[model samples]
Target: PNLLPEQVTGTRIVSQGRRESDYNLIGLTDPRGNKYYWIGPQHEGELLRHDDTDYHAIGDGAVSVTPLHVDLTHEGALKSLREAFG
Candidate 1:
């Protein structure tokens, strides 16, 4: 397959871990217990403010996006099994 310009011109990433605490800014919690962050664009300037609050900002404002996956199979398994039983 041919590579798109955007895909070819993005910054490379190395995953350290998935927990929100691993990378403070990458995953943050707000006062209301809601998480808000950029999937592929974060200002370098705001990186410093991560420690001030639970709010996190991730994915350097680059040309690419990396998706984080959390396993929901355990929770969904019962539903899946029920559906299969029918």
Candidate 2:
């Protein structure tokens, strides 16, 4: 989805990291007809941060393929807590 400056007039997602406010391109495609959501901050600096696990491999000139998981919670911790409580 293309976000225009006029479209995000009152939203907090406006580009504040750049010198001039401009919309950055972000896209997602579902080739297999599965539902997915892609949410993250856009790169706005001259040098990319190495701490981002999502796109760090891409920054190093390597092909990155990240597998998506339905649940994002820490399952190990959850299982331990469940066993302790019950």
Candidate 3:
């Protein structure tokens, strides 16, 4: 594929050390399965805020793969909390 897929923990938009926003916007898919996004105010949204993520993974010419787990519970926290309050 022309667009190489890169895995990222999350996506975000930043102006500096200060984060401007999480990755917002959507991409359009053509009949040929090519994806593209239009720059507009309407496309922005509050989506993600995961730190330790690199924008280059999902930037202009790259594809991003964010692997998510089905179980969202923190195992260590769950165990400790159970023991403390059980």
What's model 3's lDDT at 73?
92
TM-score of each: 0.20, 0.24, 0.24
Please give, for residues 12-69, the per-residue lDDT of candidate 2 as tens digits.
2121121222345555669987766655445443543344343444344433445544
**Candidate 2 deviation (Cα RMSD):** 16.2
lDDT of 1 by residue, 6-70 (tens): 54444434332223223334677799999987454343333333322212222332333335578
Model 2: runs farther than 4 Å from truth? 1-52, 72-86
Model 1 vs. true fold: TM = 0.20
Instruction: Tell me the lDDT of model 3 at 6.
Output: 57
In model 3, the clashing pairs are none
Residue range 1-86, candidate 3, lDDT tens digits: 14434533343443221234445477899999999986555634443434434344444343344454488899999999999999
Candidates in order have lDDT scores of 0.44, 0.47, 0.51
Kindly provide the TM-score of model 3 when superposed on the true structure, using C-alpha atoms: 0.24
Give the TM-score comparing model 2 with the true structure, all chains together: 0.24
